[model samples]
Target: MPARIFKKSWLIKSIFFISAFIILVIGGTTYKKIEDLSQSSALLTQTYKVNVELEKIFSHLKDAETGQRGFIITNDPIYLDPYNVGRENINSSYAELKVLGKDNIALQNNLRELNILIDKRMEYFEKAFRFSSVGNYNDENFKENFYNGKKLMDTIRVKIKGMIDSENELLRKRQQTYESNLKVTPMFLYMVLLLSLVLMFITYSKIIRDLKKIKAANEQLEIFKESTKQSEIIGQQGNWIWDIEESAFTYSDNLYRLLGEEPQSFTPTLDNFLNFVHPEDVEKLQKDVDKMMINEDLPFIYYRIIQKNGTIRHFKACAKLHRNLDGKKQLLGITTDITNEIEHFKTLEERNLELERNNKELSAFNYVASHDLQEPLRKIQTFLSRLEDKESSKLSETGILYIDRIKNAATRMRLLIDDLLQFSRTNKSDKAFELVDINILLENAKQDLAELISEENAIITSNKLPTINVIPFQIQQLFSNLISNSLKYKSKDRIPEIRIVYSKIKASEEPQISNPKKPYYHKITFTDNGIGFDNEYAENIFVLFNRLHNKDEYSGTGIGLSICKKIVENHQGFIFGSGKPNAGATFTIYLPFI
Candidate 1:
């Protein structure tokens, strides 16, 4: 109603100002200022996005140059593939920039000059490439061609940087202007609103008493009741009034609709209302009513009702109690259908319970399997050691080979059992959450691998770990598995260099590497300079029994990463791994903060 009144008043003002042309100047100024503000905001946002895209484009150009250099030095065409692809993308990107800067002639001219320079640079570089392609790899002009291209690229970068800075300055000025207009706009609008409110009050005062004298009391009551009934029906709500002293009641027809019953069946009595409630909710309903009788204000409640068809329906009831003329309390208010909302909540709850149950069952199975298998595995290892130590000379070469294979199989099985059991325990273990110092955790894991570290002459370093809410043992296992995997996958030639770091990050943006569920988390990263695998296999690496190398080449069950993933997930956190082949790997764990 207020919005409609405002619109009507604005329309009238617009017409009157058009006829007189006196207020037109002020209104035009206001409208123009608002338009400028909106346009400036939009332009500022566009410029920011353009600047980001420009930076990305620049990075791609650099990558293309790097690829070209790599291919030239090694005479490998594969390395040049990305360069050709990047060159194709760069042309389209520059075309987009031209469109973006069409409104700014100065920026467009700058870009045109940069493009000309790039053409000159590419022309010389192409000649050098042709020389190399024809087996004239010792072309004396190659160094000069590379230097010319680098200088041209540098000039292009400087021109783009200047345009970005100039646009940012323009955006800053627009923002300042926007802020000034915003401040003045509200002040002028408030003044207009104040004058309008005064005029309205004067009009109301002149006619209110006269109007009241003409309206009949019972007619007003009827109008009020009719409006209330219409509102309840339209809103899918039911209104009721309980007269405690008279032991009588009244309800809108909407109330019967809410109960899934006909109006004729509703008796407007206390027991009639109670009969509609579910048997399980009757006591709660009575208690709420009794509380209203005593306190005149019973807080809102939700309860279920059994419809005529025996279907249970949920309702949200809210009531206010007021004293009648006789000083007795009367309760009046509404019951709204909330069946859909309740059912949705129940469905979500059931899904959660189902997931929890599945996790528990998985964990229990792992524990049982590990315990049962350990006895046989221990016996096999013991027998293999005795056979190797006491009767190695008596065994034939084939027999010796069989014994070694058996030992390797037994070792692999033991590791698998251990990994599976650890994964299962994450689901069943008591979640005793506490602030864990991650720095200590990483140091502990490093210490556990001290023998391997010394043998590889590994370099290990870490930033201070944050204290976060987590299950300590699970955190330990998470760190240990990741670190061990790094060492186990190291290049046989190079010394391993590992680094652990931690930082705080928003929960939603948390790395989907592990799938964490909280709103804020500590991100711990384990980086290693080892022989990394293909990035395409990042997901497969986390699955149970997944292996990038043959078992004989890289020993152990492939369940390490899977267990680490499970532990992180159970703690409502995420873990992810990224790396280039032979460029090393980074394993990140995001554990939610308490």
Candidate 2:
């Protein structure tokens, strides 16, 4: 059994040594290459993250300067939007860059200078705003501050550019390393195949003639029967060979075990096997077996089996016809316990039905919200408009005030209806994927928000973006909602400044995304200097109608963020929001791209 015939044959054993050495070489190469690839991937992630964060700092600083200038010229508090936004994001961007670049001494040095330049620019911006606040908006003072702030801004941009250039260089190096590993992996596979062929040739030379000389052909029949028992026992299954002419059967050892019977006690016969079949399945199982016998084709059957203890379980039987040496027919087959698999399938089926019902109910609710709820609000609003037009002077002050309250309530109801309808429709958007250029998408959203941007003197800066495969309309809706939400929550005393930028990451690197066939995701960030809410409400903000502020403080239906979340999910992406109160909110979207 130990192959003692070769126990003292060192020359023969060298073949095994060669095989092991080849395996070790192949395995060691794979391990080292994988380790190198992982490190390169991590370095690439850090490089891009640091580069993006630096751009974010640069972008926010510009927003602050723009906000300061807008407030100086128009003296509108809304112009401070970007100033407050820059204050909220600049520090966080620096912190993020520091963490991402902690391994690189040069980047850290660059970050230190970046911090100094941004601070200097911000200080001049504050002075300009301070002068304007104190009635110091003279042309000479304005020109002096303006020229100084622009100089500081230009210096900050130069420093940020240097950092970005260095990171791009690092990214290039890491990508080259990763590509080299990909090339080496194929060479490893080729070497492994060559080693396997050498081993196989050596083995064939030793065994080719000796196999015919030493082993009887009949040995296979014994081996097959014994293997059947071992396999059935391991799998909690059974096997049988039926002799068609003799009307007799041979059962594997585990066949008796499967029926909860004593081994070797029961006779192998058709009636005995049928006795174990569930009462309802007996006639069908018999009919299938008779058909398989006549047709001599492989047949598969799934039925319930009642064991000796009366517990019913699922079983799958498959059989193929064979011919004996004497030309007599035989049926060789296996049966497996499929109770657990059957139960799991049933559970999933029930869940699908339940989800179908829930979808129908939701559709009905949306219909009611569209028709029943909105019609009455429309009537109230139309009547109020008519009364206000025809009875302005005749109406008493109290009457007018009551009419105004009714109109306001009706208007609020209309807003509520619209928000609800939008929320209900979020997941129902057409799922057709298209190549959506993010630059064009952002431009459309900007165009839509053009009036508000000019009214508040808001500043929006964006970097070159990518084209992503997504539901184009849904992605456009996502951009529009995120930008509008930022404008709506802008700080009262600061100008609204918004910056959009992106970083690329591998889907396998991010733990939250699952089953990524495409390796890359573009993390597009929308940061705004507005009255950001508490971090605890980050997820809560994406729930329908979950508002952090009173209606009087912020005029929103609070469903915009929820729609943004749904759209991201529809594209197999992720959306997240985080902010500190009064600091500003950052909405980060992860969308897959080629």
Candidate 3:
């Protein structure tokens, strides 16, 4: 190769000059086309304006003539309204049309003749009116004047039509010229465009090959950009750069998104960012900024920012100072949104407060149950025992019945106290949780109530149960109380039947409870075939001292279900019951398997 175009520098310069020349030729062609279009547009607009004015003149004259004839017939002033309006508007319309046609001397003379004819028609109308007023309406002179007025009106109409026809013809010619100009002028532009494309192909043939290298560079940068954004979002962190010299801030995209905003919505300035901070926290943020400014060491700050949605979020930010070779100082920092962490801490705080309040109430209850309430019930039971053992024969039948009633009342009170103590005991027990075998627990419960189960002629059946973490004695007592309830509420016609069903389930599938972190549950349901009460009392049955039946119908301390509720709660579980009137009751308990 003697000489290559790429090696010759002058060839590159020559290509640029050729490209510039091609563009100039195309631009000149476009300009000529635009000039022709502008001239055609002006002519068309003038023609339309002239036509509109001529039509206005014709319409006004016809309206005035109608008013004049109406006045001649009815002689009413109201008929003059159309005539008055036409006379007022026609002069302005004619003046505008005449001025528009001033450039064309031939049309000027024609417009002058049209204006004179319009004036003569109105004069004839006025002359007829004067003649009719002076003489009779049907006089010869008045009839001659009205006839002349009609002839003048016909001449005015013909002249207006002539002007309108001429204007329309001009408009059509201008439109043809405009269309011809667009086609002819763009031909030169197209030729010039083809030449320019050829030159650009020579210029950028290697440039396109080089652009591949640049594109790969850009793709590498994009990988870093995407990775940075992903890391920020996952860690709930965002980076920011503050230019100390310029007092400006460059925020990463995730930083803006973290504030519930789109990137590039507004520039990140100190004051602008502070606007999203809570009012109560703004002072703290401002002071932290000052501290970062003063210290050479990187500063750490924690504060709250209110998001665009009006929700408060907590943030922890730390910044390091950086200096480029150009000696420009900036602060490169990362900020982490800790809203979820803050919310978790707040939840723990609330839970601790509630536990504290419960402890205080339990202590107060324990005090009263141990001391104040137990003394009266104990004395009554002691006196009843003394009368039964030592002086049983002296009392009459009614007295003995009264003593029995009092003794029965005392026994119920004592049982209520014991159950209340048991309910309160579930709150603060020292028993550690261990894996207890449920099959053995149910057996122990049945054995404890052997005499009652035999007397009530009841049948106890249970499916296979799971070994789960629980307080052993408490779970045993839970089964015993529920089984005893079924025995006590049994109908005379049907022998009592108690079914204990246990199964394992995912916590999400269990409708009675939800613990997403702990995914599985051990479900135990104690279903009884006894005298079930109304479903309305389903929730009410778990309340302390809540009873569905009277003592004569069913006897209990009324604290058994409340104790069951407490036991389930201590095990981090749920207890729910459903029943229908005179149907059966199902008591379902959900215990976490974790």
Candidate 4:
């Protein structure tokens, strides 16, 4: 609202009018004052000029009297020349005196008296000049005429002095008026100038105060803007900002942490932030950002991050873009960490898989127990029934013995079914992880089958073992089954040499062997020197009810390897066996560290 006020139509119009009024007042006042002063200065200048001319005329009158006296005494014609020159100057000066005296009766009367004296002196000079030309220039008569001329001239000189005094007095009075006007004009102008300055200062001070208020209002607006921006950022999980003109990027601390980074450690940039995104999701994110910036087309994105600790986390960034007043489409956005959410989703998926697997295994177990195992069991029972039905007269001892053997076969079938049930039920067990010492576990397993190992003369050797975090019972069962297999399938007269080797391996071996871009792994090997099965059955060994040999030849329920496979895989690992028909078998297990 304040921003709008500065741009108001009335405010701008008022400023323009006020500024024009001030300029007009100052300009008009200054012009009028200058005009009046110019008129006064012109009058003073004219008065000074007239006064100077009057002083020159009086000086000529005095010179003319002196020249006439000098000519009468020296009898020099050169002196007459000056008198003639002065006489000629008299008429022109008289005209000037008349003009200067236009409004002054006193000065006009003095000029008339001055003209009378000049006419009397001219009459006397003319008579003297005629006597001199007619040779009547006798000293006695000439002296008398000179004396008469002196007396008349003295009287006229007194009048000229009086006129000169009057003109000097007028000049002095005019000068005094000019000096007085000059002295008072500056003081009056200074007062007016000082008043104008004070008025202008007040006006400008008001303008500056208004400007300061506007500045303060603008500062408050900025503060409000920052507070609003901060609220928006904190409410969202993470936020991003783009300066369109600057072509730069800015992100909140949450965004950096979402990408598993420290804000202070790196500058936020589109390229830098996107680099942390999983490669599979990079193209989509880049395209979305580009479209938002270029065409104002916003898009939502969910991507994964491989954290600094090598943990996988998921994130979703969402926003919409519109042009600001400046026409820049800033990409304002929020990002949220979805690692726990993704984990929960994965757990649900895994749970579903386990349930489905349990259902399938149960179905297979029921089918196999009824069809495969029961069929043999039913035949054995039928044979024994037939034996009992036909044994009328004292049954032959051999017939009873053969019937007992058939019953034994039926009993073994039932035992196999029971063993399979036990194996399938392991999936349903909620076993928690505990520290499992492989060396101690293997020794106990060997002790359980000590009699068989001693009778077969099998040598079960183990390298130094590790205490791993695992389901202890599962690990024990795993090693026991493996050892049992080695002893059971040993070549006759060739003692079994079982070797279990465990090493602390770096998580880098055969990592890319599965998928080059996948994370690394750690491997543990269990190798045995015994009669190995065919390579074709290597994968099948871990299948329920799958056997490499007939039931009559090997003593197993065919669930041992399957149980071992399940245990290793539940820990996010892989179990695979490699063997030649007669050489030996080696099972290598791989598990991720994180």
Q: Which candidate has the highest lDDT of all? A: 3
Off by over 4 Å in 2: 1-234, 243-248, 308-310, 320-331, 428-430, 508-519
Give the worst 10-residue stretch by lDDT in candidate 2: 1-10
Candidates in order, TM-scores: namely 0.55, 0.57, 0.47, 0.44
Quote the lDDT for 494 in model 3: 88
Per-residue lDDT of candidate 1, residues 1-594 (tens digit) = 323343445545554445345245547767887887788788778778667656766766777778777777887988887777777777877787778777878767877886776677567557657765776666667667777778877876887788678778877887888788888887876676565556555556534543453345446677987997788877779988877677578887889988888775657887888998999899988998788768767688988998889888899988887776557878887889888877899999999999989978876777678877898899999999999999999999999999999998888788778776766666535678778776677777777878887887888888888887777777787788888888988977778888888788887664363444557788888899899988899888998888889987888678889889888887777778888899799998877777
Sort every candidate by lDDT, greatest first: 3, 2, 1, 4
Backbone Cα, N, C clashes tallied per candidate? 3, 10, 0, 0
Query: What TM-score quantifies how close candidate 4 is to the native fold?
Result: 0.44
Q: Model 1 — TM-score against the truth? A: 0.55
Better of 1 and 2 by TM-score: 2
lDDT on C-alpha atoms for all candidate structures: 0.77, 0.83, 0.84, 0.71
Candidate 2 per-residue lDDT over residues 199-235, each given as its tens digit: 9688667665445433544376569768866888888
User: Which residues of candidate 4, in runs, are more than 4 Å off?
Assistant: 1-399, 506-508, 511-522
Q: Judged by lDDT against the true structure, how good is candidate 3?
A: 0.84
Q: What local lDDT does model 2 show for residue 102?
A: 84
lDDT string, candidate 4, 399-444, tens digits: 6786677677777777677666557655525778777666787788
lDDT of 2: 0.83
Where does candidate 3 stray beyond 4 Å? Answer: 1-316, 320-331, 334-355, 390-399, 428-431, 505-520, 580-583
Candidate 3 residue pairs in clash (backbone atoms < 3 Å): none
Per residue, candidate 3 scores C-alpha lDDT tens digits across 1-594 of: 112323454666788888998898788878878988898888888888888888888898888988888888888768889998999889888789778988978678888898789788888878877865664787887888888888887787787787778778778888888888867877777888988998999878745654565577678778988998899999989899988888788999889988989986897888899999989989988888888878743577888898889978888899888995457998899999998998999999999999989988978979799778999778878989999888889999998999999998888888878888887777626788889887898999999999999988889889999888889888988999899988888777788899999898888876667544468878888888888878888899999889888877788878999888888888888888988656678999888878
